[model samples]
Target chain A: MLAKRIIPCLDIKNGRTVKGINFENIRDAGDPIELASFYASQGADELVFLDIIATFENRKTLANLVKKVAHEINIPFIVGGGISSIEDVSILLNAGADKISINSYAVRNPIQIEKLAGFFGSQCIVVAIDTKYIDDDWFVYLNGGRIRLPLKAFDWAKQAESAGAGEILLTSMNHDGTKKGFAMDITMQLSKNLSIPVIASGGGGCMKDFLDVFEKAEADAALAASIFHYKEIEIPALKKYLNENNVETRL
Target chain B: MKVVIIKYNSGNVCSLANALERLGIRPILSDEPDELISADKVIFPGVGEAGNAMKYLKEKGLHLIIPELKQDVLGICLGMQLMCAHSEEGNTDCLNIFPLYVKKFVINKEDKYKIPHVGWNNIVLNNEVNSKLYLNTENNKYVYFVHSYYVEKGIFTSSETTYIIPFSASLKKDNFYAVQYHPEKSGKTGETILRNFINL
Candidate 1:
């Protein structure tokens, strides 16, 4: 059986991890490569690096950062943020990224999904959808969750899968930074509706939350940031907890 | 030992190169028959469609030489799939290195499993304790896999894994070895497998 994945997302700015992720043993936490190696050593199934820098000049820096992280770690690495074209995906993949995630660019040009999937197999492309609940409908949001799009979240997810996207990284904007839990209702819906894997992102506070998402929502993978970033939850201990609860995780 | 990674425009070659570099073996990536024939060990790593990849191989004349090479060859993921007799992907024929057919996974509505079985999965070693690839690695160690198509279990299967159904996770025949998972992406256990290959 395939084990459910646990992923830690890191925000990158100007070729470095944004917030300092200080742990008990480590001193400095700003180095992206160091934090990535730490996560891999702690048994993280995968790592997602969201390059928050939004300038054309910084793209090369982000690719170089990816190369450094790829050289240091021996686990799957995903690079996201401001990936708008096939050239961007090619640069990152050449820089040693195993997968590339696209959010706003996917919204602006849906055809790029087919093109990317065609050029670089569906397995290399990940479509990230940031969604919000508004007026009893889950609508898609863009520009880092500030602008709402007219498309429904469910509709866009289906379109993405048909467009040959390998996986869907679904983030709930309503529960993003809240230490509550994942939005199970829509997550389950998307997972059930699509044949491709759905990675539930946003609103992960404790080990129990991960268990809930995996067992209840049937998410293929669960991605979290702040809790892991602040050391509120250690990966090895969390995997042990999930394993004890009958959830199949890589331990 | 001069190790050469067979490169034909597949994705993730750089990751494989980096993995080899970590093991202190700086391998050369080439599709030229002369370089491939001269190497002590050859690693065929790929991440692309079966038809397009095979077409590229044929265009470069690698298709004619890969099967004839006598050196030890290791195939990963798509590389493994292309080594089989035939593939359901793109309805294309493949190298006849191993007499097996690769079929797409059929995800039933009742099953909770998704297509493109991606993530870490345990491999039940079918080889003996002294098997060249299983050196320094225990049975049932998890390895990273990312593929929708799988080769059917056959006589040459070295390891087996169950996703929706039982299939060959790794296969071996004489001088050729292939694995359906990405050892480059797998952690310590993966490093051990790569080291074993290097020693071979």
Candidate 2:
């Protein structure tokens, strides 16, 4: 059986790990590579490092950090935030990043999804959609959930799938820092509609939230930041709890 | 001991080198048949399309050199798929070292299983098989995998994993070994498997 994945997303700013509050006010968490190694050692199914600082000066820092992470951590880790073209992806993958996730660039130029998928199989390309509920519909947001687009979340996700994105990292902006739970209704609908894996992000609080996301929403993976980073919810304990609840977590 | 990683245009086989480096073994990444043939162990690692990988392997004549090498050769992910008879992906013919057909996972609307099984999944080691690849590795240990197609369980299957259907997670035929999962990225369980392969 394919186990439901528990991912610890480390938002990176200048090679350091930071956790954002609803994608805005951020504070330092730790070193990205050390946190990545800790998560991998603690039985994290996978790790995602979003380079929140996508500046020209930070590109080399991100790449150099990726090489160090690849050298140390044995588990698969994804690098995202500022990836736009094939050349950018080539540099990261060659540095030993397992997969690369894209958001703002992908939404602006959707055709790049197909081109990246064509060049480096769809399995390596992940499209991250930041969504917020407004006016009775979930709207897609870019620039770390600051800029909202006119696109509907569900429709855009379907389009991304058709364009050859291997996975969808759906983050609910409204429930991001609430620490209540994931937006189960939208997540369930998208999970049923898309053939690719949907990683429910942004609103996980406790072990039950993860259980709810997997058992109720049927998301293939669940990603959270502060909850795991701050030691509020330990990964091994969470997985053990999820497994005892019959959620099929890898323990 | 010369450990050569059979390199082609596959995506991110350098991760394999880093994994071996953690085990204190530096591997030679090369496409030369002479290097692959003379190495004590060869790792055929890949993460890309079957047809494209096979095309590159054949163009470099590695398709011919790999099977003839008498040393132990291990294949990972697409490398394992290319060792099979055929793949539904791009309708490409593989090296046929395992004689099993590789087919894409059909998206069953009723099951709703994801197309690419992209996570950590456990594998049940076949106790009957004498492959030392899982020597220190425990049965039902989780390993990372990211592929849409799978090789059917056959006489050469050394370990099995069930998703939508039962399939060979690892296969062995004399001097050749292949695993559909990424031991290089499978954390400690994967480290054990890689160590076992290196010690072989």
Candidate 3:
């Protein structure tokens, strides 16, 4: 049985963890590597480092960070944010990132998804969709959810799957930051329809929220940030909770 | 001890080297037959299409040297599949070190299973396995796996993991050992597995 993944996302800016971490018994709270090691020790299934610093000059910094994280952490991790070209992905993967995700770039030139997946096997390419429910339909958003596109989330995701995406990181703009729960309806719809694994991101408030997403939505993984960073919920305890609930989790 | 990881066109060799480094072993990345043949242990790591990987191996003449190496050799993911007799992926013929065939997963009408089984999955150690790879490790402990094709259970089977059906989690034959999961990315249990292989 494939265990449900519990991922803690770290937002990186200028090579430092932007979201302030509140974990104890550690040094250098802003150090991404330190936080990543802590999470891995706490039984995090995987980690995602989204380089929020979207500038060409900071590319070297992100690459160096990836190299450091890969050396210190044994678990697989994904690096994303501002990854547009094949050269960018080449730099990250060469720097030892296990996988990389692309967002607006994938929507801008969807062919790039095919080319990227073809160039580097689909197993390493993840298409992240930032979607929002608008006017009785879900539409894809871009530029960190600042710009709205006329594309339907389901249609774009289906197209992405056909274009060779190994997984989908679906984030509901409406449900995000609400701390209510994951967007169950849309997530379930996509997870049921798509053949690839769907990772439900955004509003992960409590442990039950995680269970709801996995059980109701059939999500392969659940990604959260603030709740973990602020010490609101610990990973090991959450896994234990889910295990008691009969959800298959890696402990 | 000298450890050499075969360097072909495949990816993840750098990560593998880092894992070995974590185990306090500095491995030599080389494609030359002499280095691979002379190393104390050979680690064949791969992540790519089987056809292209086979083509690169043949081009460098590693196809001949790898199978004949007498020392313990470990194959991972694509490397494991390539060590088998054949692969449905790319319809490519492998090195046949193990008399097994790699086949693509087929999920019956349920349509819930995902291809390229990603993330952590537990492995059930084969009964009375002699490899010592799973020594001191409890059964059903999870390891990281990311692949679409799997080797069928056979005489060389040492461990098994079930996704939709039972398939080879790890295979062993004489000096050749192969695992479908990524020990390099499997955290502590993975580190233990690698350490066991090094000890062997």
Misplaced by over 4 Å in model 1 are A19-29, B128-130
What's the distance in Å from true for residue A235, model 1? 0.4
Best model per TM-score: 2
Error of 2 at A209 (Å): 0.9
lDDT of 2 at B181: 98
lDDT of 3 by residue, A1-251 (tens): 88999999988888777653222122222778889999999999999998765799888889998999999998988999999899999999989888899999999999999998888889889999989999999999988777899899999999999999989999898877668999999899999999999999888899999999999999999998878877899999999999999999998
- C-alpha lDDT of residue B95 in model 2: 95
DockQ measured for candidate 1: 0.85
List candidate 2 stretches off by more than 4 Å. Answer: none
* lDDT accuracy of residue B37 in candidate 3: 83
lDDT of 1 by residue, B29-88 (tens): 898899999999999998888998999999999999999889889999999999999999
Please say which candidate is ahead in TM-score: 1 or 2.
2
Deviation in Å, model 1, residue B168 alpha carbon:
0.5
Best by lDDT: 2
- lDDT (10s digit) by residue, model 2, range A4-79: 9999999999878898778778898998877888998998988898998787778888899999998989887888
> Mind giving the per-residue lDDT tens digits that candidate 3 earns over B34-58?
9998999999888889999999999
TM-score of 3: 0.97
DockQ-based CAPRI category assigned to the predicted complex of candidate 2: high
